[model samples]
Target: MVVRVFHTATALANTLAADVARALRSNPRLVLGLPAGRTPIPLYDELARLHRAGRADFRRARAFNLDEFVGVTAKHAGSYRAFMRRHFFDRINVPKARVDAPRGGARDVERECARYERAIARAGGIDLQILGLGLNGHVGFNEPASALIARTHRARLSLKTRRANAPLFGDRVSAVPREAISVGMATILEARRVVLIATGESKAAAVHQLVEGPVTTRLPASLLQLHPRAEIWIDRDAASRLRGARAAALRRLRRSRRGRSRGRRAAARARGSR
Candidate 1:
């Protein structure tokens, strides 16, 4: 796991957009796993800008959302599908046929989950996954105590999760669905690369737990520590609790800069002596 702290949300979003653009440039058909939430909105905006400038192409890219609230149709104002379309899909060149989300209102949710999992497998897995840190360290809908290696399934939303999302439903906790269909932890860990973005002081504690806490089911995001290609990008406010980690990263950066400077100086001296 690599942790990068940025001074502002825009900086974090810009860096994330650059990485996504590079991936798409390298593989136009990349299968991307996307998350829905405030943290990723800025990144999506940046990606849209890149697409408009012809710097990034998404015509061949495929996307799958991480989760959707059960009982909500795609047309629902607060549905994750609606959120994605409004913030990203409608703005990019990606074909609508290539975008998919779990069927939140499916009568046979078990079958739907299986089908969605198969769809991802058939698409050759995700090349890159974008994630946001939940206040309680949940990823997708895999709340605390969720099975560490579970696959796609229906999840009963925790009260904290519902409360956190209440504002999206007009501040009515009752308006938020109690269940959701989510890609599980095992599915997310299978992605070729995972990028998690977090901002604001509300995320500080969860960010700390993810970066420095032990790998425990109580903090689901902590399980990313087991992934080989996971990167965490967070704003300064989100990383405020990681004092030691920040200092260490600064020291390593300084050393790298010093090494480069010394190499240049040595090369110049040798040229003059010659």
Candidate 2:
């Protein structure tokens, strides 16, 4: 696992977008596992900008969304399908046929999930998977549990997950679906490269735990620790509570800068150069 901290949400977004664009340039047939959430909105916009400018070509790329609301159709206003179209697919050059997602409203959601799993495999598995961290430490709706499922499956959305999704449902928690079909942790770990982005102070605790805590199932995102190429990308606000690794060095740097500032002030005072 790798942890990268950026100065601001925009910085993280830009860097991540560049990384994706570069990867796509290297492999036009790249398969992407995408996420839909507040954190990825800017990323999708940046990728669209790259496509429009002809900097990155996605014409041969294929994409699979990480999950969708179980009760909503793909055309539903709040479905992840609509979310991706509005935020990403509609703006890129990738053909509609190549971008698919779990059918949230399928008559048998579990079957739809299994189908999605197979579809990903048929596409030769995901080359790159981008994720957004949930406040409760989930990735792709794989919530904190005693054990985790390895294949795409129907999942009961946690109350906190529903609340977090409320904004997309007209800011009404009651309007958010209680169930969803999410790609499994094993699938995400299987991706050749995985990057999880988080921003804002609300995610500080979870970010801290992901980088500084144990690899326990209670914190599902921590399981990324086992992935060879999994990366946690966060902004300063989200990394604020972290205490080890680069976080400790950042704190020390700040204190050193302050000390130098104080020394300069004292020297100026001694020279009567107020």
Compute each candidate's TM-score over C-alphas: 0.89, 0.91
Q: Which ten residues in a row have the lowest lDDT in candidate 1?
A: 245-254
* Range of the 10 consecutive residues with the lowest summed lDDT in candidate 2: 248-257
lDDT tens digits, residue span 1-274, model 2: 8888777788899899899989988998999999999999989988888888898788899999999999899889999999999999999899989999999889998789889999999999999999999999999889899998888998888999999999889999999999899999989989988999999999999998898889988888998899999998988889889875677865765677689899999999989964
Clashing pairs in 1: none
Q: Would you list the C-alpha lDDT of every candidate in the order shown?
A: 0.90, 0.90
**Candidate 2, after superposition: displacement of residue 190 in Å?**
0.7
Model 1 misses residue 123 by how many Å? 0.4
Candidate number of the best TM-score? 2
TM-score of 2: 0.91
Error of 1 at 230 (Å): 0.6
Clash count, one per candidate: 0, 0
lDDT of residue 257 for candidate 1 = 64
